[model samples]
Target: MSLIDNINKAFDHRIRLGIMSILMVNDYADFNMLKELLGATDGNLASHTKALEKEDYIKVEKQFIGRKPNTRYSTTPLGKKEFQKHIDALEKLIGK
Candidate 1:
């Protein structure tokens, strides 16, 4: 298969790309942190996150902190592998 064919369509959106990039570096990030970093609205972030979740690219954790609900996101092992593949494909496409 060609390198371009290896690209993950799930990351076609810049928002989803940003989400994976952040998760790659951080062990885990909460909803508020992602929203603030991406400068996206609650609905925007929620939808994007849900998409990633449905693809099994990210794991979501829910809990309560001092009576407040908290949602954290982290990349799964499979996610890391697939994301790295996507990055590699992009690099190859650019002849890097």
Candidate 2:
């Protein structure tokens, strides 16, 4: 298969890519942390996260922190596998 074929469409957007990249290293990240790291607005981040969630690439957890709501995100096993494939494909394409 072609290198391009290994790239996942779900991670096409920069925000989604950033999210996955962060999750790859961290156990989990909360909404504010992701927003700060990705420099995405609330709506933009929410949309991209929802897209990832729909693709089953990320798992979302909603809870209350002393009466305040909090949302955390982490990558699923499938997500990690697919994202690694995407990175490998990019590396191959770049001759790295």
How do all models score by TM-score?
A: 0.96, 0.97
CA lDDT, candidate 1, residue 56: 97
Q: lDDT per prediction?
A: 0.95, 0.95
Determine which window of 10 residues in candidate 1 has minimal summed lDDT. Answer: 1-10
Per-residue lDDT for 1-96 in model 1, tens only? 687798999998988999999999999999999999999999999999999999999999999999999999999999999999999999998889
Instruction: Provide the global lDDT of candidate 1 against the true structure.
Output: 0.95
Q: Provide C-alpha RMSD values for all models, in order.
A: 0.8, 0.8
Worst 10 residues of 2 by lDDT: 1-10
lDDT of 2 by residue, 20-92 (tens): 9999999999999999998999999999999999999999999999999999999999999999999999899
Off by over 4 Å in 2: none
Q: Give the TM-score of candidate 2.
A: 0.97
